[model samples]
Target: MIPTPAFVVDEPLLTLFAGRFEAALERHWPNSILSYSFKTNALPWLISHLRNRGVWAEVVSDHEYELALALGYPPERIVYNGPVKGRERLRAALAAGSMVNLDAKREVEWAAELGREQPDAGLAVGLRVNWDLEARVPGESATGAAGSRFGFNVENGELDAAIARLRTGGVRLAGLHMHRNSRSQSVDVYRASASLAAELIVERGLELDWVDIGGGFFGSLDDSPTFDDYVGAIRECLVGAVDPARTRLIVEPGGSLTAVPIEFHASVVDVKWVGDNRIVVTDTSRTDLDPLFRRRRPFAVDLTTASSATVPTQIVSGFTCMEDDRLLTLEDERELRVGDRLVFRNVGAYTMSYQSTFIELPPAVYVRDAAGAYTRVRERASVSDYLRGNSWLSPES
Candidate 1:
C-alpha cells in the first residue's frame, strides 16, 4: 500500500484537462501552441507525460531550459523565457532556433551579438512586453502600482530602444510576449493583454510570427473560466490585426493545466487539546503541499472519518515543529479520528514544484490510472537518498 502523506495524480482527470485545453485551442486558433509551463510542476514524470502527449515546454530558467532539453524536448520545441537565462545557454538556444524571448538587458545584448556573428542564421527572437496591465484592467494585476518587474517596460520607452537595438544588430524581432499574472483571471484581463499586443503590433508595424498571450487562466475550479473562455477572448482582440494563418498563437499554462489533476493525501496521526483548542495533527506538513503557506482560501477537502460523531472546531495542523504550520481549520464538521485521511484538491500547481525537504524528506508520488490502479512513480526519499549529491567529509582520527 502507498504510504500516507503522498501525492496522487489522477491520470484520467489529467488527460481530460489536457484534451480540453488542446481542443479549445484548435477550435479558436488552429495555428496555436499549447506549451506547458515548466516551473508550475517540473516533476520528471509530469514532464515526460506531457511531452509524450506532444505539448511543448515553456521554461523560465537556465536549469529549466536544460531540464527540458534533457527530457527530450528539441530546442525548437522549447520556449526559453525569464530574466536569469545564462549567457552560454542563451547563445546556444538562439543558434538552435529556440523561441528565446529576451527578458534581460544582457539577453538583448547577447542576441544582438549572435545576430552580428551569424548574420545568415536568420536569428529570430521575441521581446517580452511589460505594459501597465493595472491601469487597463484596474486591480486585476497582482503587482498593482508597483507594476511587473519582468520584461521591457512599455511606458518607459525601453521597449522601443530594445527593439531598435536588436534590429540594428541584425536580429529579427519575430514575436511579442505579453504575460502578466492577474488577481482576477477574468476574460477582461486577457482581453486587455491581447488588445495591447495588437496595438503594439500595429503601432510598431511589427510583422511577427507569433503572439504569446502568457498564462494565468483559471482552470478546473467551480465557476472558473475555461480554456475556451480565455482563447476566445484573445482571438476576438487579435483577429483583425494578427493573422491566425501566418502568426501562431502561443499560451503557456502552468497552474491552469496542472492544478486540478493532483491531490495531497495526509493521514491523521494525533489529536491534542491545548487551552480550549483542539488540534488535529497529520503525518504531512504544509511544506509538502502548500510550500508558500499563503493560501487564504479554503481547499476543497474530503475526509475519511473513522467516526460519525461531530466536532465544533478542529485546527488541522501539519507535522512541522513550527507553531504556525497549520493547513486549515475544520469547523462544524465530522470528528477526524486517528487513521482518517484528508485529501486536498486543486493543489497540483506550485505545490510539487515548490515542495521542500525540511524536517522530513520528500514523499512518494503515485499516479492512479483510470481503472483505480496505483503505481508508484517516485519512491519516498530516504536519508541516503537526500544525501545523494552532497559531499561527505571524513573526520580525522
Candidate 2:
C-alpha cells in the first residue's frame, strides 16, 4: 500500500481539461498557441505527457528551458519568458530560434548586441509590455496597485526607447507580449488588456507578427469565464484593430489547466479537543499547497473508510512546527476521525515545485489510471535521502 500523505495524480483528467481549454481557443482563433507554464509544475512526466499532446513549454528560467529541451521538445516549440534571464541562456534561446520575450531593460540591450552580431538573420524578438492599467482601467487593474515590476513601462516612453534600440540594432520587433497577474477572474480584465494592446499598436504605428497576452486568464472555475469567453473578449477588442490573419495569438497557462488533476491526501494523525472546538492534525505539511492555502480552499474529507465521524467543528492542520500550518477550519460540521484522509482538490499546479523537506518529508507520489491501477511514479523519501546531501554526513558515530 502507498504510504499516508501521498499524492495521487490523474493524468487523463489533466489532459482532458487542458485539451478542452486549448481546443476551444484554437477553434475561435486559428493562429492561437497554448504553452504550458513550466514554473507552475515542472514534473518531467507531466511536461512530457503534455508535450506529446501538442502543448509547448513556456519556461521562465534556463533550468526550465533545459528541462524542456531534455524532454525532447524542439527549441522552437519552447517559449522563453521571465525577468531574471541570464545572458548565456538568453543568447542560447535566441541562437536556437526559440520565441524569446525580453523582460527587463538589460535584456533589451542584450538583444541589441545579439541582433547586431547576427546581422544577416535580423533577429526577431518580443518585449513583455506593461502599462499602468490601474490608471486606465481603474478598479479593473490586473497587475494591481504595487504595479508589476516586469516588462517595459509604456507610459514613460521606455517601450518607445526599447523599440528604437532594437530597430536600430537590426532586431525586428515581431511580437508584443502582455501578461498581467490579475486577482479577479473577470473577462473584462482580459478585454481591457486586449483593447489596450490594439490601441498601443495603432498609436505607435507598429507592425507585429504575433500578440501574446500571456497567461493568468481564469481557468475552469465555477462561474468563471471559459476559454471561448476569453478569446471572444480579446477578439472584440482586437478584431478591427489588428489583422488576425497576420498575427498569431499565444497564451501561457499554469494554475488553470493543472489544478484539477492532482489531489493531496493527508492522513489524520491526531484528533483532540481544544476547549469546545475540535482540531485534527494530518501527517502531511501544508507547504506542499503553496499559493493555494491563501484563501478558502477546495479540499474534501474522505469519509468512506473512516470508522467514526465524531467531529462537528474542526480545525485541520498539518504536522509542521510552523505555528500557522493550519490548512482549513471546517465550520460546516463534517465528520472527521483519526486516520481519515483529507483529500484536497485544485492542487496539481504548484505542489511539486513547492514540496518541502520540513520536519518530515512526504512519501512517494502515486498516479492512478482510468482503469484504477496505481503506479509509483516518485519514490518515498528516506533518512538516507536527506542525510546523503549533508556534507557533514559521515560514518564516524
Candidate 3:
C-alpha cells in the first residue's frame, strides 16, 4: 500500500550532500569544522549520522543542546546560539564547554558572570555581527538582514562596544560570527561576506580562532545554482581573504545539507470547478505540507497516475477553511482525479520545521534507507496526543 500524505527522506541523497560539504570544508578551511545546524532537522537519527561523519552540532536552544548531548556531541564541538538564552541553559552550556555566540549586550554580562562563577571553565565567547548585505538575486530578500532581530551591527559602534564590554568583563573573545541574508545561487555574495569578515577581524586586531560564516546556503532546488559551482565560488572568495593556516572556518549549513534528500507526497482527493477556476483538493494543507506556498516559492511538481491524460488550467488547494491554503496553480489544463499522487520535490528544509496542525495535524514521516526500503520515522499524531497535558479537560479526570 502507498503511504498517505507523508514526508520521505532519501538517505543516500543526504549522505552524498554531506560528503560534498565535507570535501568543500577540507579543500578551503583544511582543519576547519562544518557543523550541521540542529534547528533545521532535529531528528535524532539524522544528528547521529552527522556526528558519526565528524560534523559538529550547531544548536539554538536548550532542547537542541540537550539533543546534541544525547546524540553524543561533546560540549566543545557544539556551538550554542540564539537571541534569547535562559540563565540555567546558559549555565548548562557553559559548564558543558560549548561555544556561546552572544547576541545582545545582556548576554555579555551573563557570560561574564558565568566566567566568574567558573574560573577555570575556559569559556570561548563569540559575538554575532549584523552585516547589511542585500540579497544577491534581483528582487529577492532574505529573512535576516540589517533590520533583522538577529546579530549586532559591526558597521556601527554596536560590535565595537560589545567586544570592549566582553573584554572588560574578562570574557575571552574567541572569534567573529556573522549570519548574512541567505544567498540564492550567488557565490559572489558568500565570497563578499567572507572577505568582509576577514577585513573586520584584521582591523579590530582581534585574535580570531573560528570565523563562523553562518548558514543560508541554498539546497538542490530547480532555481538554485549547482552545488559544485557555489562551493567553488565560496572557496575562492574565502581563500583570497584569510590565511587558512591561521584561522579555522566554521560553516553552519542547514538547508543545503538536507533539502534535496526529502520528498513530500499527497494524494489528490477531489477535483471540482470553483467559479472560473478548477480547484483540486488534496489530503494535505499548507500548514502541514507546504507552508512555503504562502510565500510564493516554487517547487517541482509531478503527477503519478495510470492515465497520461492532461487537464486544462487548474488550481491545487487543501481542504481547509482558509482560502489562502492553496499549493500550486497549473496554467495548462491538467486532468486530475481522486487517488492521483502529487509529488513535491526538494522539501527537506523549512517545510516540516515550520509546519503546524492548524486544522489537522500533519501525517507521519518516513525514511527511505540506502537499500530502497521505506520505514516510518514519526507516527501521525492522534487526537489524544493533542489532548494530553492540555489543562482544559472535561470534568472526568
Candidate 4:
C-alpha cells in the first residue's frame, strides 16, 4: 500500500550537496568555517550529517541550540543567533561557551551580564548589521538593506554604537553577521554584500576574527543557479577585501543544502468535473504539504502514474475546507485520475518547516537510498497527535 501523502528525501542528492558545499568552502576560504543554519531543515539526520562533515550548527532559537547539542555538536562549534533570545536561553548559550551573535544593544548588555557572572567563562560575541539590499525573490527583502527588522542599520548609529559599547565594555567582538538577502542566486548581489562587509570593517576600523556571510546561496535546481557559480561569485567579491591570513570566513547555508534533495508526493483521492474545469482532490493540503500555496507561489508538479501518455489540464485541490488550499491549477487542461500520484519538487526548504497540522496532521516522511529503496523516516501523525495537548472537547465528545 502506498502512503497517501508523503515527503521523500533523496540521500544521494544530499550527499552531493554536502560535497559541493565543502568543496566550495575549501576553494574560496580554506580556513573558513561552514555552519548549517538549523532553521532551514532541523532534522536530526541532516544535522548529524553536517556535524560529521565538520560543519558547525547555526542556531536561532533555544530549541535549535538544544537540538544541536543533542546531535553531538560541541557548544563552541555552535553559534547562537536570533532576534529574540530569552534570558534562560542566553544563559544556557553563555554557559555552554557557544558564540552568541548579539542582535540588539540589549543583547550586548545581556551578554555582558553573563560574562560578568562567569568571568572565567569568557564569552565571544558578534553583532548583526543591516546591509540594506534587496533579494531576487519576490516579497523577500535583504537583511542588510534599509527598513529590515533584522540586523543593525549601519547608516544609523546602531552599528557604531554597538561596536563602541563592546569595545569599551571589554567584550570580545568575535565576528560580524549579516543575512542580506534571501534569494542570493545572482552573483552581483552576493558580491555587493561582500563588498559591503569589507567596507564596513575597514570604515569602522574594527578588528574581527571572522566575517559571516549568512546563507542565501541558491542550491542546484533546474530553475535555480548552480552551487559553483554562487560560491565563485562570493569568492570573487571577498578576494581582496578580507585578508586570507588574518580573517576566517564563515557562512550559514540553509536552502542550498536541502532544496533539491527532497520531493513531496501526494495521491489523488477524488476527481470531479466542474463547468470547464477538472478538479482533482488529493490527500495532501496546502497546510500539510506545501505552505507556499498559501503565499500564492507556483510549484512545479509532475504526474507519476502507470500511463505513459500526457493528459488534459486539471485543477488540483486539497482535502480541506479552505478555498485557498490549492496545490496547482493546470492551465493546459490536463486530465488526472484517482490513485495517480503528483510529485512536487524543490520544496525541501520552507515547505515542511512551515507545514501545519491544521484540519489534519502533517504527512509522513520517507527516505530514498542510493539503491532506490524507500524507508519511513517520519510516521504519519494520527488525530490523537493533534489532540494530545488540547483541553477543548467537541460537543460530540
The candidate scoring highest on lDDT is 1
Model 1 spans with C-alpha error above 4 angstroms: 392-397
Which 10-residue window of candidate 4 scores lowest in summed lDDT? 136-145
Name the better of 1 and 2 by lDDT.
1
| Best of the two (1, 3) by lDDT | 1
RMSD of each: 1.9, 2.7, 3.0, 3.6
Clashing pairs in 2: none
**lDDT of candidate 1?**
0.90
For model 2, what is the error of residue 272's alpha carbon versus the real structure, in angstroms, after optimal superposition? Answer: 2.5
TM-score of each: 0.97, 0.92, 0.89, 0.89
Tell me the spans in candidate 3 whose CA falls farther than 4 Å from its real position: 135-146, 183-185, 221-243, 331-334, 391-397
User: Residue 369 error for model 1, in Å?
Assistant: 0.7
Alpha-carbon shift of residue 262 in model 1 (angstroms) = 0.7
RMSD of 3: 3.0
Cα misplacement distance, residue 167 of candidate 2 (Å): 1.5
TM-score of 1: 0.97
For model 1, residues 1-397, the per-residue Cα lDDT tens digits are: 4688899999888888888889999999999999999999998999999999999999998899989999999999999889999999999988887888889888899999988998988889999999998899899879889999999989899999999999888999999999999997998999999999999999989999999988888887456688998898899999988899999999999998789999988899999887766799999888987799888888788998868888888999999999989988888889888889999888899988887888998888999999999988988889877666566543431
For model 3, residues 263-352, the per-residue Cα lDDT tens digits are 888998998997878788998877765665655576677887776666567788887889888888877645778898988878777777
Ten residues in a row with the worst lDDT in model 3?
Answer: 136-145
Q: Write the per-residue lDDT of candidate 2 for residues 57-109, one digit (tens) a residue.
A: 99998889999999999999988999988899998898888998988888888
